[model samples]
Target chain A: MYEGVVQDLIDELGRLPGIGPKSAQRIAFHLLAADSTDVRRLAAVLVEVKDKVRFCRTCGNVAEGEQCRICSDTRRDLSKICVVEEPKDVVAIEKTREFRGRYHVLGGAISPIEGIGPDDLRVRELMTRLADGEVTELILATDPNLEGEATATYLARLVKPMGLRVTRLASGLPVGGDLEYADEVTLGRAFEGRRLLDV
Target chain B: MSLYRDEGVVLRTQKLGEADRIITLLTRANGRVRAVAKGVRRTKSKFGARLEPFTHADLQIYAGRSLDVVQQVETIASHGDAIAGDYGRYTAGTAMLETAERLTAEEKEPAVQQFLLLVGGLRTLAEGSHPPGLVLDSFLLRSLAVGGYAASFDDCARCGRVGPHPFFSVPAGGVVCASCRSAGAVTPAPETLGLLAALLTGDWAVADASDARHRREASGLTSAYLQWHLERGLRSLRLVERT
Candidate 1:
């Protein structure tokens, strides 16, 4: 209706999460005005994302091959599995360097408002992985959001019934703020999840 | 018959008299709704657990004068039990619930994006896949984006100039320049800004790759931005641990 392939690009880009109609048009026009080589490069990258990036066979993380690096690695502790929502969360945990365990990505969290249920994620795969009896504990690392919490609870119930230990990451007050600055909820969490000092 | 069956997550429930309660829910098809659960507080009630907060239910609610009355209910996911047992998951879940409640204001607000975000967020949380803090941040960033208050990171929040500036002024929208720091603004570190950008955009590669300090810094910015937009601060966010 508007132009050639430019119209299609705008429509597709507009479908992205943050890109709006205005941004879509701007990006489409930019692509049209850019060098053909760069445009082709962008297209290649997009194609590669689908072709090259796939879920890890064992853990469900985005990987270039059959298994994600963490799942395939020999050094990490397979007995300790850190359960997280997406492949991206693996990166977050890796950055901490405090954990040396393998991971299981759930792909997404649960929110009934959006019609997402426990059955929608890679949860069944997790149950399958746990059946081997190699893993001793499951550290639920889903985000501290409602969906993440719901996901953790759902998993704990399912996993615990199988006689596996399920744990959640602790919540508390942040570092850069005084007690005066913290909200009632954070304060409550900090008080509830208080860590014991070994003094 | 008004087609009574619908699926919804109980966002919040307020005690009403002794045996009844008011429930706020976000439905799969009808969007946000407020309803009453009669005698839900009684010990012998059939579906009390199904109507509790954080519980997903397939419900039939008869229309009432002020609110709909829950007639029959089936538990879709009894998440509250597992969540309530763990302090961390419980707090994080509460924060998400409150945030969802705040975002889905205005009955039938046609917030398809928000509805999806909450559902997806809750699922991730329930599965115990990521750290609750990370999940909360993801939800907050996405929620803000859905609410039209998305924070800018690589670009100026006001001017559209692409940058890696670290200044964050929630009232000014997002990241700012040295020159654009609004009055009473805090200049977040460049790393913090980058982390925030990743969170805002769901670039978990960037976010998960960030250092703990940077994630915490970004989280502070996120909370401030969320509080600014929500006006009265998210009652549950305080319970979430940033680290």
Candidate 2:
């Protein structure tokens, strides 16, 4: 523990995810040594973000208003909704510029060890969105990991009776990754999902 | 500081910084150890994908003051991919990992039996040889046994009386005879007790031939017993979709 406010600052910073005690202390000292204007700017942005941003009512994506930009965009296909685990994943998919459709952010995956279950996520909201039968295709863009796959499987089973064409993202080796260095499971998946090359 | 090599299972991981991760591993010889794997969050990380949960890896670690650093890691079994593809297996595997972590509460203590049980459970789960739920239950029972909390299915837990016990009591260690039966003791079907015994003893043929209803009953009893012994319920066990 340090003197008064310095310890308080470290404790506060440490509460943030991924910021451990050592890093929190280091950051607090760095902030104290740096210009007050920079620290104030960062503080202001943090408050501003919490005050202005909210989850989109329809899709659960982070938004400034009732709906996110993707949810509000009429040009995007409403008949398709690419479901992702987080808003950050939405940005990653959007950067590809390939998916011209709406999105449903599940907030987080079903991590039982973390005590996050189907009920904790935005699953009910997603089910409500699909109840209208407007979405013709539901693309599961969840990360290809344990929790992500669990969430996808749960959602897939839930929406199977709804007659929606559900699909999942193809997972394989990275573009520049070497085949010899690839793990057997990933290599096997790459082979299983091999595509025909077009010249 | 010295460097050492060990084969271990990746029990869990937490993000340490922008591009680093702190991994908790249950090693075959070293027991539970937490190590910082620098740059594992980066896209180009050499062994990042191999260090995921349920993965068995051969790791070279650099001993540090507060935490050991993972210098090199090579994949031994990538069970994560197989487990993740199926919901039943995924939940079961998650529960197994959690149990392994919980059983080996002390760090750097050799827990070869617990380690072997986890590896075997993960392998069986990945192979789809048995119902994922059964494998998970078996793992839990065996891990508890190795952790010195073995529950008795046959005979009495408290009085050690002979003959098949009729009542199961969580607080009394396991199945209790009428003479030793305490409050809140449950009378599971004879088949549920048989199923639990089969799972604990690795009698897969009997376990596989068991009915679904018995399996469900056995699962409930097993979970209750586990919670009672551990003094807390496993979060992952609640999410397991029994097959």
Best by TM-score: 2
Question: Could you tell me the lDDT of residue A176 within candidate 2?
Answer: 84
Candidate 2 lDDT over residue span A57-81, tens digit each: 9988899999899988989998999
Please, what are the lDDT tens digits per residue for candidate 2 over residues B175-223?
9999899989999999999999999999999999999999999888888
Cα-lDDT of candidate 1: 0.77
Off by over 4 Å in 2: A1-44, A177-180
Q: Give the TM-score of candidate 2.
A: 0.92
lDDT digits (tens) for residues A107-138 of candidate 1 = 88765444455677899999999999999999
Alpha-carbon RMSD, candidate 1: 27.4
